[model samples]
Target: MNYEAVIFDLDGTLIDSMWVWEQIDIEFLQKKGYVIDEAAINQIEGAGFTETAEFFKKHFNLAMSVEEIKETWREMAIKMYVERVDLKNGAKEFLEFLKAHNVKMAIATSNGREIVEAILEKHDIAKFFETVVTSCDVEKGKPHPFVYLKTAEILEVAPSRCLVFEDVPNGIIAGKNAGMTVFGIEDAQREDAKRRAKDLCDRWVMDYNEVIDILKE
Candidate 1:
């Protein structure tokens, strides 16, 4: 695909940090005397950071306000992101390839600004992107197309000329809804997610290496 700008969803797409969330969810909910389940986790799959916090508050009937809930999760997840999260396989190389080709890039993520900034700064790849937009920056989250469209707008790229890389079905749908082509990245923990993402995305790949090879052609 010929594209001008490349927009990435951060968690499982640009970084190997999805596991950090899974672990945080387990530990957080367990602390509140609740057991996290697949159904509960699925409920917020593509939701933004604030939206996810709201879900936790409503579903779990927690006494905390949305902001407090977010703060708690942030505290729980930040150290993990800063200490353990790394770029996806070949992600830096692909970013360099895009930079060399002068293809504009940006991040459209559901994660909060703090976590996103920390991880990007940790990898020193923040320089590659023109902008980094969180779901909080938009009115709505994935499956709504707002975040992706917002990123494209900020990049000053038309939706049709932008390419999105996402790892989840809702995110793929968001890119498609924005009238952009999307490539789905495979998630090792969820085979079902891979099938769903494949069905939704324009293309699917195991890692950024495949994308680099294709773009090299």
Candidate 2:
């Protein structure tokens, strides 16, 4: 596909930060005297931090407000995202290729702005993206198409001319629903990510190298 712009989902797509969330969930639940379960994780899979906190409150009957819960999670995960999270294989090279080709780049992420900016700045790749649009910026998150569409609009790129790179099913659906081509990045953190990518995306790749090759063609 001939693409004029590239939009990326931060966690699991450009950065390997999914593990940080998994650990946060585990630690949070253990502290609350609850055990982590697949069902609980699934419930929050595609949700943003605020949405996830809402789920936690209702599921656990917690006394904390949504803001408090979100703040707690941010406190738990921000340091890790900044200090430990690193770019996925070939991510930096691909970003450089897009920059060299003058292809506009932006980030559409469900992650909070604090951590996203921290990780990107820490890796010195924040300069590559013209802007970062978080779920907090939109009323709805992925699978709704609002976030992706907003990113395309902000970048002044037509949805048809944009190519979205995502690792999760909701994000894949969001890109396609917004009338853009979506490429799936393999993320081992989500057990079904590869299968879902093949099922929902316009293209699927194990890493950014495969995507670079596709763009080179």
Candidate 3:
């Protein structure tokens, strides 16, 4: 388990911001005279920011362009990310440990760059990461391996030497697809979803503290 670089998924994995998106989805659809449902949410589960917007426009039959949809979500999300979001328990400590070890780090997130930057700065943890790559920076999002591959490339690390921390099945698959070891970070997902994630990842943990303990051994 000697990984030279670590890549993380931002939302549910690194921070407790997944709830923000769930709320945004409900409000956004309500504003558009549509209702949010399980099916609608499932359709964009592993999508990148742009891909999610595209899905929203098409599936919701909204008149807003993809960019407009993205803008609306960004506008609704930025304040929450900057003010309300916090890192998951033990995340900062694990980050500090990694930094002390001189391990390279990066983010491969489906979230927009604006909110990601805002939250990173808000937490004052931006210095811990060497790079941040959003799904918009690549051709596809999670489950496709594009963003993960792009991040490893930016870190100048081979895929085999990289470790990815993810919360969902798609993100775990993306890391594995990139030929990196994947660790599943538990989030607020349903039991079934958590089981699926565990099945896909090389390891699983409820928080970064568990990882720190393991590494210390």
lDDT of each: 0.90, 0.86, 0.91
Name the regions of candidate 2 deviating beyond 4 angstroms: none
TM-score of each: 0.97, 0.95, 0.97
Task: Single out the weakest 10-residue window by summed lDDT for candidate 3.
Answer: 37-46
For model 1, residues 1-217, the per-residue Cα lDDT tens digits are: 3899999999989988789988998898888999887777789988999999999899999989999999998898889988888889999999999999999999999999998888888999989999999889999998889998999889999999999999988889989999999999877658888788899998888899999998878
Greater-lDDT candidate between 2 and 3? 3
Clashing residue pairs in candidate 2 (N, C-alpha, C atoms within 3 angstroms)? none
Q: Which stretches of candidate 3 lie over 4 Å from their true place?
A: none
**Ten-residue segment with the worst summed lDDT in candidate 2?**
188-197
Q: 58 in model 1: Cα distance from truth in Å?
A: 0.5
| lDDT by residue for model 2 (97-121), tens | 8999999999998888888877877
Q: Relative to the unseen true structure, what is the C-alpha lDDT of residue 200 in candidate 1, on a scale of 0 to 100?
A: 90
